[model samples]
Each structure stands twice: as structure tokens, then as C-alpha cells.
Target chain A: DTAVSQTPKYLVTQMGNDKSIKCEQNLGHDTMYWYKQDSKKFLKIMFSYNNKELIINETVPNRFSPKSPDKAHLNLHINSLELGDSAVYFCASSADRGDGYTFGSGTRLTVV
Target chain B: AQSVSQHNHHVILSEAASLELGCNYSYGGTVNLFWYVQYPGQHLQLLLKYFSGDPLVKGIKGFEAEFIKSKFSFNLRKPSVQWSDTAEYFCAVSPWANNLFFGTGTRLTVIP
Candidate 1:
């Protein structure tokens, strides 16, 4: 079974449209995260939730919001996507603060 | 702010070549280090991690990493690499939080 799974493996949208990416993890982890990987392959953490509570929120713009309904799911919604929003969004989960995360196959978001 | 730095952005080698990728972090406190690999069209998978106890940690697929506290570095190494080892490797560090600070990945091309 895939420990971490993300929906919409690829997404292409217009500049003013909004989109959402869903993520789920069956690892029973307590912490879930959303990461953005740019064309240069630089991965940056955007948000993190611990047991459905927001714990880490980086300097990401308000256009991007992460919602975790429970410990198993974390979803990202982007409002009025722009050209700069074109990047791979990855979902990850970890059992604890000291454990390495299990990452899902990234969702490639391209804003035209 | 905590940051992770990967020295090598791209590397190419023939089969059976020894491999080493340098990773450095800018955090003085206790931290967790990890090396994650992303194969072509695949999700990111944990290669190795260092939390505490023995500084050297072994991981899947013949991968290993050493944590040097004095240098604030955790470098991944493999004695012999195969063609299947071609992937993008990411170094990440977490200091007292669930969020990871990732470095720009290193793309490895192992020629057959």
C-alpha cells in the first residue's frame, strides 16, 4: 500500500483560476506537511499540521492555504493562482518530530 | 532561520563508482537530518536519517549517512553505485520542529 498518496498528479490551470490538491497518508502519522519544489528542485516547507492543528506556517502568501481535516489528510488550496505558482507540490507525513517523513508522489502544478 | 545547504547540484558517474553528497545545516541546537531520494517519475523516499545515538546511520538500497555535529553536516555516501541509483537527492534538517528545511536537490546521473 502507498503510505502517502496525493491526487491530481498533474494540473494545468489559468492565471486567475483556483485549484486544490488533496493528500492522504495511511501511516498513522501525527504530523503532515505541504512542500513546494521549484523548477530548480529546491524544496521548501510551506505549512505543517500536527494532529489537525496548525503548527508551522512559513512565509507563504495568503493565497495558499492548507487545511487538515484530520490526522490522515491534508489538502492545499491555492486562490487566484499566478505564473509564479508553477511548481511541484508535495505532501509528506511523519510519526514524530524526530522521524523522517514519508512523501507522496508530487503534484505538478503549472499555471499558464 | 535554519537552512540546509547541498554542495553538489549535479553529479555524473559510471556504474560502480563511489558516491558522496555533502549536506550542511546552519542550526546549533539538536537537530534531525535526513537524505531523501526521488527516482524518475517517482515520489521522494527516505534514504537515511540521523536523530541520535551512533552518528553513522544506514538506510535502504545500500545508502548511508554520517552525522558530524562539530561540522553541522550529514553527508550521504554509497560505496558502489549502480545505474539504478540515478535520482535527485535532497538533504533536510529539522530543529525542534516538525517542519523540515530542505536544500536544493542534487541530481545524480549514473551511467550504465
Candidate 2:
């Protein structure tokens, strides 16, 4: 079974458009996270949710928001996307803090 | 701020060549180290991880990593690589939770 999965493998949109990426995990993990991988392939954490509670919110713009309706699903929403928002977004899950991180197939966002 | 560092940005090797990728982190507290691999058109998968005890850890697909506490280094190695092993490798460090700080990934290509 696929442990973690994300929808919309590739996304191409106008600079000012809005978009959303959905992620789901069957691993029954409590903690889910969102990461952004830039052109340089540097991965940075954006947000983390544990059991429907927001645990970590990094130094990211307010344009990016994450929502977790439950423990098994986490989604990312971007509003008024800019050219700089073009990058790969990855969704990951873990049973607990720093334990067995599993990443989903990344969503490549292209703002043209 | 906690950060992970990967020395090699790109690596090219012929088939049957040994492989090594270096990773370092800047953190004084206990840490969990991980090596994740992303194959072409696939999600990032766990290659190996070191949480505690026994610094040397072996992962699937003939991959292994050794954690050096004093140097804060976790280097990955594979005895012989095949053409199919061509992928991007990322090194990550987490100090206290599942939220990770990743280094810029290393894109490795093995020529058959």
C-alpha cells in the first residue's frame, strides 16, 4: 500500500492564480508536514500538524496556508501565487516526532 | 538555526562504481539523521535513518549510512551502483520532532 500520496502531480498556472494540493496518508500517523523544494533542491519545512493540531509554522508567507481536517489528511492552499512560488511541494507524515518520516510523490508547481 | 549540509550537488559515476555522499548538520542536541532517495518520476523514499545507538545503519537496496556524533556527520554509501540507481539523494536532520531540515539534494547519475 502506498503510505503517503499527493494529488496533482504537476501544476501549471498563471502568476496570480490560486491552487491547492491535497495529501493523504494511510500509515495512521499523527504528524503531517509540508515542505517546499526550491530550484536549488533545498527542502524547507513550511508547516506541521499533529493530530489536527498545528505544531510548527515556519517563516513562510501568509499566502501559503495548510489545513488538516483530520490526522490522515493535510492539504496546502496557495493564494495569489507568484513566480517565486514555483517549486515542488512535498507532503510527509510520521507517527510521532522524528520517527519514520515518509514522503509523498511531490507536486511540482509552475507559475508562468 | 538548525541546518543540514550536503557537500556534493551533483555526482556522476560509471556502473559498478562505489558511491559515497557526505552530510553534516549544525546542532548540539540529540538528532535523528536520514537519507532519502527520489527516483525519476517517483516519490521520495527512506533509504536509511539513524536515531540512536549503533551509529552504522543499513537500509534497503544495498544502502548504508554511518553517523559520527563528534563530527555531526551522516554519510551514505553503497558498494556498487547500477544504472537504475541514478536519482537525487537528500540528507535531513531533525533535532526533536518529525519536522526536518534538509540539505540541498545531490543529483547522482550512473552511466551504464
Query: Quick one: best DockQ, which candidate?
Result: 1
lDDT of model 1 at position A75: 98
On a 0 to 1 TM-score scale, where does candidate 1 land against the true structure? 0.95
Give the local distance difference test score of model 2.
Answer: 0.91
lDDT of 1 at A14: 98
Off by over 4 Å in 2: none
lDDT of 2 by residue, A35-91 (tens): 998887778899999989889999999999999988899999999999999999999
What is the per-residue lDDT of model 1 for residues B1-112, given as tens digits with 9 covering 90 to 100? 6678898999999999999999999988888888989888778888988889999999999999999999998999999999999999999887876868888889999999
Docking class of 1: medium
iRMS values for every prediction: 1.3, 1.4
Provide C-alpha RMSD values for all models, in order: 1.3, 1.3
The alpha-carbon deviation from the true structure for residue A28 of candidate 1, after best TM-score superposition, in angstroms, is: 1.6
lDDT per residue for candidate 1 within A4-51, as digits (tens), equals 999999999999999999999998899999999888888888999997
